[model samples]
Target: MEREKIKRIVSKHRHEKAAILAILHEIQEEDKQLETESLNYIAQLLKIPVANVYGLATFYSAFSLGKKGDTKIRVCSGISCHINGADEVNEALKSKFNLEMGETTWDEKFSLEKVHCLGLCSIGPNVAFNLVTYPKLNKERIETIIEILHKRTGDSK
Candidate 1:
């Protein structure tokens, strides 16, 4: 993103409490991820330590240190989901997307992650595709979802 835009974002919150958090949020909203140069600029402008800025970016799961895929898939690995074949679901996703956990596809179309729980134990093997949750997943169900996700992204695969 343009430095002027980032400067404007930081300038907006410079006098506010917990301005760093707000600045980070704005940057993420605009860029979809936080760049190191932007973080440094923010730190320099705020007169705070660069480590502090970087630390906040890393500490929060909401923050992405680098560019992320268009679609983010978070498979639930809670005890209930685990017992109900979450592992199998994860494997299916990995195989389909050619990605391991905490990795994004080379096309930047999809990213995979393992999260603790979706708070719906009864629906074991839950998966969060973007913001929506899919429950009671199996290999077949996962396949259908994958097709839909791919279609949405205009990927023939």
Candidate 2:
């Protein structure tokens, strides 16, 4: 989770002595893909090119250059979810997070990402955080989730 630690981890594999792609792959696996900070740190620690890291990160959507959220809220915008009030669900989430699509909440507790499908069209209007899915969601339910999230974060910190 820390840059210096990532650098140190990557340092265990020397570029001249190790496989470049293997190092990048390993870094990506450990950090859920190349975060820009991790990428730069990895490059700096190993004396590799930043562009190489950037190139690899960009080459794969599995990579991310920025920070991810503690809770990733993915709302399916696929056709089935669309007809079943995905728009309303999307709006409610946006309003609740005070964010548009593809944005993370200011507190960094939640990030809203839209996907084409969640593979559950039969359960349309799907909303999920990590792995917990809520089907047939409404505004009221959305509000409840927000409240619960606030409380949970409050208690943890």
**Clashes per model (N, Cα, C within 3 A):** 0, 0
lDDT for 70 in candidate 1 is: 71
lDDT of 1 by residue, 1-157 (tens): 7889988887788534377888888888678689999888888888888999999999987778877677778889999998888888999999988888888877777778888888999988899877889998999999999988788787723
**Model 2, global lDDT:** 0.72
Q: All candidates' lDDT scores?
A: 0.84, 0.72
Q: How large is the C-alpha RMSD of every model relative to the true structure?
A: 2.1, 4.4
Candidate that scores best on lDDT: 1
Return the TM-score for candidate 2, rounded to 2 decimals. 0.71
Model 1 residue 95 distance off true place after TM-score fit, in angstroms: 0.7
- TM-score to true structure, per model: 0.86, 0.71
Which pairs clash in the backbone of model 2?
none
Q: Residues 81-141, candidate 2: write the lDDT tens digits.
A: 8997888888988887787776666656777888878898897789988789888787788
Error of 1 at 75 (Å): 1.5
